[model samples]
Target: MNIDSIKNYPTGSSVKHKRKITNALEYRQESAELCDKKSVNRGYSGSFTGIGINRAAANDFKNLGNTFTDKIFRSKKFQNIVEIFENKTVVASTLVALIVAGVARPLTNIAMAGDKDKEDSMYAAAHAISSAVIGFVISSIVMAPFDKAFRKIKDDPKKYLQGLEELLDVKEIGKRKLEKSKPYKKISKVAQMIPDTLVLGVPKAMLTIALIPPILKYVFHLEKGKKKGAAPQAAQSQNLDVNNNAVKNNPAFSMIKGGVK
Candidate 1:
């Protein structure tokens, strides 16, 4: 279809169309990688704990993860995260594993080592207690910021939803023009429901827990698509090939083609 046709195509229809060629696996992988980049670039809380000096600074560093998570997911950014994770479960899973391994395990061990009755080793015990207290305090402080970010994601559900809409809308338009056979329509309808399922199903709720980084990543790709121009071109040489094949088999045109030479 020509660019104008695609542009004029109903948004609803375009979405349904694009859904066909759009590979879920690729989208998921791309989104997952993008999400990781954002998380790292934005500064996970652990990255801020430099040198461990200045208890207050360390405390801020400790909570940096929450802050970063809260900020990205609370805004349109959350959609990007969701899109990425939709395809890449490993990214999310690995992150959770790392958090528990790196943060929780050490804290629990230290806290247990600081038993109050260890008088003979009171200094070591006291050090453990002090360490545990600082860790807890820092954690609590960081959690506040993280919670704020999470609230932001909840506050704006449309960012990623809009992205999905744009994608789905374009696909619908493409399908109507390119694949209008009755059988194709049935398949298209089923395909259209996948995103709806994703948005409405268990993943929707889990987004809050996992921080919706994958969705946010997909949104980023959408933005990039817009920047690169998502609008399809009709005048491009490829269209001629498409049109030629389409009309070549017509009964009236069949003789006309073979008679040309």
Candidate 2:
């Protein structure tokens, strides 16, 4: 072979090898760029998917809460309770008073005492009983007529609401319309509460305080007494027993006892 031909052959072979290496490097760089773009697209898609899921969960929770509330509001027991509170205002007020005065107050007093004793407990109980009795009795007697009138108004709004048309802001009122009126409902509820909360509250408390001492002395036998002659005491005890027996045997007393039971 010729020397010039051999040298040219080696140079051409080297140039061909360099071009192949450059092509390979370019292909690798293009593949890496495509991978990066795909990764970014996947990341964006994943974030969107997460956001959609969260929004769906939130909407589901809101719907569930609304459905639960609607069920509670439409329940029969809830309606009955509301009916009783509206119709038996005096009785409802008395029950609240009894719970606060007869049950909660005595328990609170005993719990708050630093050094508890029988005398302290007895005194608290006596006050509680007296307050409960006085509040029940007075509220029943005082609010009966008002409750009856309100019932009459509820039953016959067309007849009863004629006098208070201006105050109620409706020219024509019927039972159905009055029941549906939000403003009238609110006003009537407040009016029903006024006798117990405003008119009778302070007076009942004062009367209860006044009667506590007498209740403790006579009912609970809390006071100390001087000894009496045995013969007179025996006679008094006999008469008291006879009176109690007679009262117990009375037809009216028997009927009352049965009714209470």
Task: Report the lDDT tens digits of candidate 1 across residue range 207-236.
Answer: 322332222235222221233221121111
| Residue 62 in model 2: lDDT | 62
Sliding window of 10 residues with minimal summed lDDT for model 2:
229-238
- The residue-by-residue lDDT of candidate 2 on 68-163, one tens digit each, is 777887789878867767787866767676777668766765676555244455454555556576677877888888888888878988886676
Candidate 1 — what's its lDDT?
Answer: 0.38
The TM-score measured for candidate 2 stands at 0.49
Kindly report which residue stretches of model 2 are placed more than 4 angstroms away from their true locations once superposed.
1-82, 111-118, 163-171, 223-261
lDDT of 2: 0.59
> Number of the top candidate by TM-score?
2
Clashes of each: 45, 0
Query: What are the lDDT figures for the candidates, one per model?
Result: 0.38, 0.59
